[model samples]
Target: MDALLTVVVPVYAVEGFLETCLDSVRAGLTAEENAAVEIIAVDDASPDGCGALLDAYAARHGGLRVLHLSSNVGLGPARNAGLAEATGRYVWFVDSDDRLPPGSVRAVLQRLRSSVPDVLLVDHLREHPDGRLEQDASSPLLAGPATLDRLLGLQHTAWNRITRRGLLTEHGLRFPAGWYEDVPFSNPVLVAAGHVEVLNRVCYHYRIGRPGAITATRSERHFEAFAQYDELYQRLDRLGAPAAVRSRVFTLMINHLLVVAGNDSRMHPSCRRRFFRGIVGQYRRHRPAGHRVPAGPAGLKHRLVAANSYPLYSALRAAYRLAAARHRATERPPAVSPDLSATPRPVQTTSLR
Candidate 1:
């Protein structure tokens, strides 16, 4: 059967959670949709048993195709390989450590086939360590045509959206090779796409705080986020994107810098220094006209960053830590579930660098 949708899952060291993730993909579809769905699982030279497990599943499944690379390419190149091989009309990217909720595939496919939009944006539930689910609330604002101007609030992860393969090819879009690859790739996709739709349902289960997960662990690689945003702005400019779209991306860049800077403990001094310098460079290069710093601590932080004031930046970090400690002191403990242990963990590996 010709696949209506192709799911591209780039697997690395995700052996501990791959089975559950694949299981969710299997169970999420209705019988008919399952038959029409094709899964392309790319094993980017996983150091563990993930490749063998994917091959085993492929051997038993009719619509599964497993690709094993000769060497460990990063996630971006692995996804490019899968995208090149996909034959489905529409393509969806999924992470090997995450999964789809039950009935999600069926519901998404129903809407997808009916509307056949160039890009389909959907919501996700963040699954915390204690088994709590927090659904993202930005989908309501995405209903109309003005979504490109509001890209910062949207989840930029590739898997949360299903996009037409033709649209990607038309725009000559491919992921950049780095930690913050999604920002460059996703921002352009949303900007170039003509027909976009948002599904307000929480279709994906995104695990947060899992050990060894990219978001859970921090490294100097986090600093790569600045370069990624620089790429985004460059791409937007080359493509002649509207000023409003460019402004939104610039704001998102600012937000990303603040996020990395706020984690003072995880960052080395050298990394922090580079972060401040890089953000200031981006602000000067990309800050839209009429953008003013609002009055607040955040505004002060932005101002300090603009001026490249190291002492004030350090002070802000200290203040942020104190505020966070107070908040933690006042917060109640999370409700723990008995099945928390059942939740899977990502495999630990240092090969991404």
Candidate 2:
């Protein structure tokens, strides 16, 4: 039997959550769908017995495979290792701290078998620490093939998308070994894909880990995001995704920098200063060069920051937050949406650009 899907779950030090994740996956699939799946759990040299857990899963499951990294490579490298080993037509990368909401692999594969999109973006459920379930609010950014406006202007995360295996590997695509590597690779995926599928189903359950996730900690890349922003902006203009693409990109850059400004001591104080100054410079460049101003909270946040210093900035920021909270008070993910419709997959595809 040919495997239609390869599910890559990077094993980090989530000893507390690993078993539940695996068991949830096991319960989600049936004999036939499970049989058609190849599960790869890359143990990223976790010291917390996660590698042994992967071994145990491999021992019991006929379809499970383990990729044990020699050392603690970051998220991007661990995923790259799994990508190198994947043999499925489509790839679904699930974080160790998260799990699918049953039959998701089969659903994703069923869609890929016919519609054949470069990637399928699914709605994700974000689980709060208190066990409240709210569907992720940012899954619908790409209306079709990603444009510069869409990639940069809209919201995105790595957790809620499925990539076609051949398209990914043929391009020799791999995650950059950086803290927020997904930003670049994901943007490129949409840029390079012919068409993308947007499913409104909440298939993946993402846990919200405040104060502990690497994203909360300031690092070298935390400051380097400005460089990445500049690079993407230049690349998008070169690609001609549209002027709208630049608008989105501007929004992302502003949002990222402001968040850095708000970050207290997580990043080096000097690094924050450097990042802020760079953003101020970037804003000046955009203003003179005539880039579209970013919209929503991102744009408002940046404008407020540009006009004020510390205590004033903080006070103004609170108003924006309250306004945002009101805007989101009534929005919710679609309860019933397009599932794996029986549409025939496309036989040919070209670059989105």
Candidate 3:
């Protein structure tokens, strides 16, 4: 018999806080939910003692299981391993560094049972070390079955949701390993799911100050995103994505590339024109609809940025060649210590702040 839920957590060098993570997960679950929740902690062969710690947890806890990988397979593969081991009817992917507040597991389980949607989303609250809570209202709960096109331009952070196991398995959803993995991995899953449910209640407490987070260090990984979107587009095309959905996907990719390009003047000043040209060129190949997506500052910025970036593919390429390498040598998130940190870890607390 399948377990009710599989909570897959990919653990890295979080030994500094693994116990806290486990405590929180344990605390957040209801008695019944706890019985149903099978913790699959994928130890990515961290040089730290996280693997041993996971083993310890498994030794003490009947519901928790430890998976020790021979090599660090990165987030996507670690998660895939957990899924392969999951005997749960439902699956929720949670980061090991973060903690769930009280009742979160129960809430997610209840939503899964009542709604039975292909996916269920919970709002996440940003907690600063100072004990203040900033709500992530980016995605208020969305109701009913959502389509691929509708989910486009959607604010997605996969941690804040519980996905139906059948939906994922049926659609063959899996994350693409490496940087910017979420978009290619998540968007396709959301698209494939026929129905989705979202809750405004914040069930997740995201820990931002953790070391080596995606945005915590600066690296060439992001620049690779420009090419990643291109890959996503190619996959979508091969998959024979719907025309409307295809257009939305392209537009989304264009928007993401523009946002990141604008941030790095050196990279964009060099690559923008060529990159923009490539984008427009590829976009034209797709043959989008007569309805020009509403022309806004973003669209205008995309056009202007594209223009500024062009005609100097040589100079841009030259700059990017060095910049990515230089940036690659640097740490990710590029900056140490967030300029702003909020306080009071956010807790769903059953709809209470």
Report per-prediction Cα RMSD to one decimal. 6.9, 5.2, 7.8
Screening candidate 1 with a backbone cut-off below 3 angstroms (N, C-alpha, C), the clashing residue pairs are none
lDDT of 1 by residue, 1-353 (tens): 56888999999998988988887777846678887788899999999999999988878765689999999889988999999999888999999888887777786687788777777777677778766866455544454443456544687778877888998898788888888788888868777777776665667888888887767666888878877887887778777887666666666678667777666445666677777787888889888887766468767877887887868888878887899899999995564342332232221111100
| Arranged by lDDT, best first | 1, 2, 3
TM-score of each: 0.88, 0.79, 0.76
Any idea what lDDT model 1 has? 0.76
Task: Show the lowest summed lDDT stretch of 10 residues, model 2.
Answer: 340-349
lDDT of each residue in 22-54, candidate 2, tens digit only: 776666667887776787889999988999988
Backbone clashes under 3 angstroms, per model: 0, 9, 19
- Misplaced by over 4 Å in model 3 are 129-131, 140-150, 234-240, 263-291, 305-353
- Arranged by TM-score, best first: 1, 2, 3
Model 2 misses residue 317 by how many Å?
A: 2.4
**How far off is residue 239 in model 3, in Å?**
5.6
Best-matching candidate per lDDT: 1
Q: Which segments of candidate 1 are over 4 A away from where they belong?
A: 136-146, 264-266, 294-296, 333-353
